[model samples]
Target: MGSLDELIRDLRRFDRRKEVTNALARKVREPVPPVRKKIRKRAIEVLPSSGGFGRWVSKLSITAAVKLQGRAAGIKLKGRRKGFPDKQPKVDLRRIDQGRAAAPSWGRRGEGDWHFQTVTPGFFTETTAEADEWRKAAVSAVDEALGVIRRG
Candidate 1:
């Protein structure tokens, strides 16, 4: 039979993996903020949570080593269904301190201004540049978690 210490070590490994997943997801989504305005004027204000890309990306799940998969994709990301009976697509805006009721002027009803635009290629370059740093931080966090396990 495995010792109690072995079980504890296994649990710590699982925790570390979860932490790494979160870190990777954060890194993947880091570009959304800056890319928002570039993608469209007032994109940060008009769209909930910078087009809801950041929030969607933040929900990314660990699919592979040091990598993640999320709902935000293509030129558009269909968000969660909202409204009691209407069941309309919801935009997550907690990141920007605004709710659906505060849609931007362009986003108001009857505006007919909602259009899709692709993210600039430069955004990917800028975000990937910092990937190493994010990874390092995640590694550090894992080390800390493991250290705590060891001490305990």
Candidate 2:
């Protein structure tokens, strides 16, 4: 019940509070962990489990701890789903999902002799679709943080 300027300052201060920042981060990250696990599981199922490429690819779902940046909370929704060994970024999940990955032609001794395998497709896409609800939840969380309660 203060002046408009004071109320605006207080709102800004509230937005910058540690608890609020954490809440915002939580909202952003809420969709990630479970989706990550599902993607990992799917990776195990669809991709070959050799050279630990599939395993490392599955490990790409990283949820960093909540961070406050310039009075705003942030988190990244990421997946590399990139490569192997967890250290070196090799392989590309998108290409693989699109059937672009190639396995070395057995008994051949050159990089020129690589063949794309015909495995089941759409593992990443289908599984990721299942987490759509969490996205809506995240949006609603942001709205709530702004004191905008959703009805319906």
Candidate 3:
């Protein structure tokens, strides 16, 4: 019934301008925590810790957020090379992830100067595969958030 300009102005005042955006942001961000936890657990199963520093799995981190611009959301998993700072760690992450023997190292408390056994490659790919469901959840969350915005 209103003019296009009036419709736009009203929409800006009580709806899409902020309420929709905030609701959508919360919705989109909801799946990230569970996904992050699943990823951390999978990392431990896929990556071995027995003969290595056992720290890389613990170092796994996830960062996720919906941008305030109301345009985007993202999830990032972070981890470090075993010998971050470029020194020699008991076993390098890249080497273990690739199913290769660690070059050489002597810092492990009781296992002086040892070669770590090759871990099966694809650990990187498989560990995060469990989170594929997260993408689906995120998509549905957008719909839920839009519905909430409309109801308001």
Query: What are the lDDT figures for the candidates, one per model?
Result: 0.37, 0.58, 0.51
Per-residue accuracy of model 3 over 1-152 as CA lDDT, tens digit each = 22223323344546455665566556556676776666556556665666543335545545445443223423333334444344455344455556764534555533355466656565544555657765665556555554554466
Error of 3 at 24 (Å): 2.5
- Per-model TM values vs. the true structure: 0.29, 0.55, 0.48
Q: After superposition, how far is residue 128 of candidate 3 from its true place, in Å?
A: 3.6
Off by over 4 Å in 2: 1-23, 49-56, 62-76, 81-89, 107-114, 148-152
Model 1 C-alpha lDDT per residue in residues 50-101, reported as the tens digit of each score:
6574334334221213322233311121113232233224533222223223
Order of all candidates by TM-score, from best down to worst? 2, 3, 1
Badly placed stretches (over 4 Å) of model 3 are: 1-15, 51-55, 67-127, 145-152
Q: Rank the candidates by lDDT, best first.
A: 2, 3, 1
Candidate 2 colliding pairs: none
Candidate 1: the clashing residue pairs are none
Consecutive 10-residue window with the lowest summed lDDT within model 3: 1-10
Task: Give the local distance difference test score of model 2.
Answer: 0.58
Single out the weakest 10-residue window by summed lDDT for candidate 1: 72-81
lDDT, candidate 2, residue 33? 73
How would you encode candidate 2's per-residue C-alpha lDDT over 67-152 as one tens digit per residue? 43445444335455443253334666666666566666774636466677765566677776677855665556555555521121
